[model samples]
Target: MAEKVRVGVLISGRGSNFVALEEWNRRGDRAYEIALVASNDPDARGLMAAKIFGLRIWAKSHKGMERAAFDMLMDAELRRHNVQVLALAGYMRLLSPEFIRAWEGRILNIHPSLLPAYKGLDTHRRAIEAGESFAGCSVHVVTEELDDGPVLAQAKLRIRPNETPEILAQRVLKEEHRIYPEALDTFCRTLRGEAQPTISSDLKK
Candidate 1:
């Protein structure tokens, strides 16, 4: 392993996606390593899980601070840890524009609902109500606009008959766990001029 890229994962709540990324990185056959797991809320359930892995954890409540202040605090911690890439797992906070520009092209996110559709919360419900045949998740670059970044990869699942939003969310989450790490892997590898994006492989439905 020739100095894999150092990655920091950000999350706000239960970090199932963070676990996926960490597990993948732990496999010892990757272009990146998980250096830090950070959260805005100290009580986030994911923090406890990170502890089980003995991973470095950082947390600060964003309660009173301005968004920029909180972002900078997290930013300083990331820089201190020499994190080269940021994977936003389930981070619920909106990032400040400055932070986005500071780490442009270095941040990745996993979003539910095939994107360009339900850009924010309640994605599963929207998809179910629309009578769409399929629902999916996306891993993409984090831009200033919320969930409006360039999609790097996606995994889709067909909508089941009479499916409820809760059930749909559960299914989409599985695909989210499946593809986020892969997308992050390819994004770093390709950006480093190591390989080209495999379009055929990315459309994993």
Candidate 2:
């Protein structure tokens, strides 16, 4: 039997998407393993979610730590877990370029926007304010430039004119739950050499 792909997830919020990934990993048919959950916010609720699954958790705050110091600590934790692939679900911090280059194409992130659009926070509100016909989420490979990485997969939903930010956010959340795990499955399968490299070449550059 082939070995399961080890995944290390990073989150900075309640971890709704993380919950979905955990559920997928629990299924007997899946080919991936949940190796660890790391959070930049010490108070992030995802830490509790990780505990519920008995997964190893790492929490580091940048309160007094320098950028390089924090990156070094995070690098140590990732290496400790021997994480073959990394996923960012609602992770808030801008990872240092050094850290990203070290992990390179192994890291994935789920962004609330369709991507190459609203890159940072307030994604839902901005989409609504723009009167967009559609708003969705994206799962992309992490690159040095924020949200500029090659796209893996995306789930899009039409925006209702009357939609509030909260409503739009919830709708986007549903797409996130679906696409994040799907992208992870794609990534893990590729790593195990069980699948062809379906990821976009644009991501590596």
Candidate 3:
């Protein structure tokens, strides 16, 4: 059996996507192990969810800490766990450029919208308002620029007329759950020097 790749996940909310990754790993393929789950918000539900999976959890309040200081703490924790890859699943905080440089290609993020468009908050709302025909999610490398990295995979859905942002968000979230794990698995495989699977950027509704 091959040694599992160690992974550290960062989350800010319910961590539905984090749960997806965890569940995927539990199926006995043993390609990767979720070594740690860390959150900036002590109250984040994801921390509790991580506990349910019997994974180690770390929480710190980022309210008053300087950006670099906070990120340094996170970096240290991840390193302590010997994490080879980091995944940002709705982690909310914008990482500093210094942190990005340190991790380089090792960090991955799943954004709620197609990249190079709706790069920031209110992504679903902005896409709806822009009269887009499609709205979806993108899993990509984490770079200094937010949501501007090379897309490894995407799950797209056609936008229905009269669709509210809330409704669209709920629908797109399902796709987010589906593709994030796939992208992360592919990423881990690449790190392990295994045969890389053909990953598609387009996932039809």
Candidate 4:
């Protein structure tokens, strides 16, 4: 039998996507396991949610520790948990190059834009402000540069007229939850060896 893929989830917000992945795991179909959940913020609601689901949790505030040291701590926690896959649901900090290299293709992040497009914060606002015809999310490998890694899968949503940034954001978030787990599923089952990431557009233009 193949070893179950152990996963570590990193989040900075409510962790809706993380919750979705956990829920998906409980459905008894996936071969992945959420071994740990780590947050940079101690106050994240996801931390509480993770506890309710019986996941190990860790937090390290970024205010005082140097970047490298903080990453070392986070990396150590992931190692301790035997995390084979790292997923960033809403992690807000920029990871260092060393950390990225250490995990390499093992780490994944879900960004709220089509990527190579709106690559940073306020992605929803930027997409709406730019009057984009379509906007959605991308789950990609984490690299040193922000949102510049190779994308694994993407789901898109049409931008409607008179759509507020908040509304567009909500729509994008829905897609985020839908695709993150699906992307992981693909990675584990079909694309584990290929590693040839591509643009999957069942939901977008």
Considering every candidate listed, which one attains the maximal TM-score? Answer: 3
Q: Which candidate has the top score in lDDT? A: 3
RMSD for each of the candidates: 1.6, 4.2, 1.3, 2.0
| Residue pairs of candidate 4 with colliding backbone atoms | none
lDDT comparing candidate 1 with the true structure: 0.87
RMSD of 2: 4.2
183 Cα displacement, candidate 4 (Å):
0.6
User: Which segments of model 2 are wrong by more than 4 Å?
Assistant: 197-205
Error of 4 at 90 (Å): 0.5
- TM-score sort, best first: 3, 1, 4, 2
Compared with the true structure, what per-residue lDDT tens digits does model 4 show for residues 9-122?
A: 999989999999998888876757899999999999999999999989998788888888999999999999899889998888888889999998888899988888999899
For model 3, how does the per-residue alpha-carbon lDDT over 1-205 read when each residue is reduced to its tens digit?
A: 6678899999999999999999988875846789999999999999989998999999999999999999999999999999999999889999988888999998999989888778889999999889999989988888888788788888888999899999999999988888888788888887788857454666565
Query: Which residue pairs in candidate 2 have backbone atoms (N, alpha carbon, C) closer than 3 angstroms, thus clashing?
Result: none
| TM accuracy, model 3 | 0.95
The residue-by-residue lDDT of candidate 2 on 1-205, one tens digit each, is: 8888888888988988899999877876676888989988889998898999999999978778888789889889988998888888888888898999899999999988887899988998998888888888888889999898888887778887688999888878877887778778877888887775453211110
lDDT of each prediction vs. the true structure?
A: 0.87, 0.84, 0.88, 0.86
TM-score winner between candidates 2 and 3 = 3
Number of the candidate with higher TM-score, 3 or 4:
3
